[model samples]
Target: MEGVAAHQKRKVMVVADPTRESAAALEYALSHAILETDTIILLHVENPNAWKNPIGSLFKWPSLPSSSKVASSPSSEGLGNGAASLGYAGGGGGGEMEFLEALKRACEIAQPKSSVQTERVAIMDGKDKAPIILSHCATLGIDLLIVGQKRTLSNAILGHKRSGSLRGLDTAEYLIENSKCTCVGVQRKGQNAGYILNTKTQKNFWLLA
Candidate 1:
């Protein structure tokens, strides 16, 4: 037990979105961070602009319900050309409900006995979401914040097709710089390379997983 850590209960918040990077973050947290005594908060910082701009990129997941206002499949082809198609008019803040649910299922599967909380915070106007996340961390007394890092090659190849108006990639790096709690940025480097992580103390630190 020389190198083992003492048991502690903490709130771990992972930003849940419809991107593979977000999924990778959650997967990393479950495998490396969360404990049975720790609570997991699946946070979704919704960018209203994703729905407002017809061409802005938003997530589409297979697990999403067919009637979901957001993308239900991994294709931008379904976005159409209006806010109505994206359900931007305001139904019940259920825009990302299904997507969050999928993340919840992943947490449950990873830690069956762990307590989990979920929330969706909307970014108002053109304000940056990093401050919103910090506010939530303060209010929730979070101990750790895990954000997903998008691959650079993917961005160069996919261009705006992946990021669009959401700018989630920027949000992740911002949290690493400004989060009050212990924040971590995760990027999957495939099965062989394990992972590349970013933290307040380390930049692009490679972990063997």
Candidate 2:
């Protein structure tokens, strides 16, 4: 047993989102997975909007800080900065604070009894979520990636184009097909069919979403 990897803790990254499916997948991993021999990292990537001005490149601030007014407001309406507005408001604190709170809540519910440690950190500025995740895996020596599968209509209809925003696939497709590490696409609670984890025996990573 000593030479058989010793059941080392598996680094699992759960891509957190505002959807019920994501939550379900997270809970499943916690309850069924090796709690003492696995590390779960929950990450919430704020998507970039097409309308925000690229001011982060010219300024010292990493992405724009959210407005106090926007953060204080109770409404969840879209921001004016377009793409930048999509992720974390214009500022780092506004949108990020909320993301952290959500991540903590998710962990509390998913791994109530498990003593596993988790880190809820924001994606680096100007870096896409996919690449950031991959980089994090390499830096942290992660062994696996767990992502929630999003459901979308398979039929696009008469000449209607399929939207990329239908599910969480866009954020994960690249990693699924090209990651150096193993990636698991969790469609529902305990469901594991849309993709394969054995990197040596699979081709074409497909996530329903």
Candidate 3:
């Protein structure tokens, strides 16, 4: 009975990057959605350009093994030791490393560090960020996925672009529309005010902070 109950907790995956937008998504998850029993997965994707050298880049993190599912509550001690083992091997990945660490700090600030168990995953970005992210979500059986989004001028007026534009497919937009699980695109409203949320069924839904 204990094992079955433990396996039922929700799994929340928040895409983490150094951008202000990414921070807002993390903030939204921590503030409004997460619960005490939730397991947080912080996923950081590194652009190919950011790597410079694929073989030696410190940004490369091991991919999730094929057999893993989203377990209910991973051990806090194990998470700590695993993170410590993933130290940078001296390269140009400092900035990316700092990004995930900052997001983790946000997690800790929201919930007592001892109570919130978290996992960190860094992946090398492929041609399209959304598809790779979607694949991982499926692999992990994530319950909720959150990614930060900035409302572009075009999107604000025409909804989101239907196809790849000069800037390519909007990752957050694609995820919100297509991810298998419930996916949220959170946009912070300036430096204050509140937030604008986009989901599969809603667009520009405002939530006053």
Q: In TM-score terms, which candidate is top?
A: 1
TM value for model 1: 0.68
Native-to-model Cα distance after best TM-score fit, residue 135 in candidate 1, in Å: 1.0
Q: lDDT score of model 1?
A: 0.67
Q: Residue 76 CA error for candidate 2 (Å)?
A: 28
Error of 1 at 30 (Å): 0.8
Taking the candidates one at a time, how many backbone clashes does each contain?
0, 7, 0
> 1 or 3: which has the higher TM-score?
1
Query: Can you list the residue pairs that collide in candidate 3?
Result: none
Arrange candidates by lDDT, descending: 1, 3, 2
Would you list the C-alpha lDDT of every candidate in the order shown? 0.67, 0.47, 0.63
TM-score of 3: 0.67
lDDT of 2 at 68: 22
Q: What TM-score, computed on C-alpha atoms, does each candidate reach? A: 0.68, 0.50, 0.67
- Misplaced by over 4 Å in model 1 are 1-7, 52-97, 153-169
Q: Model 1, range 1-209, lDDT digits (tens) per residue?
A: 13335466788999877666776787678777787778999989897767555332354422222232223334324444212233332222555335566567545645767898899999999677888898999999999999888767533243223322335447776677677888888888775456788776776677775
Worst 10 residues of 3 by lDDT: 63-72
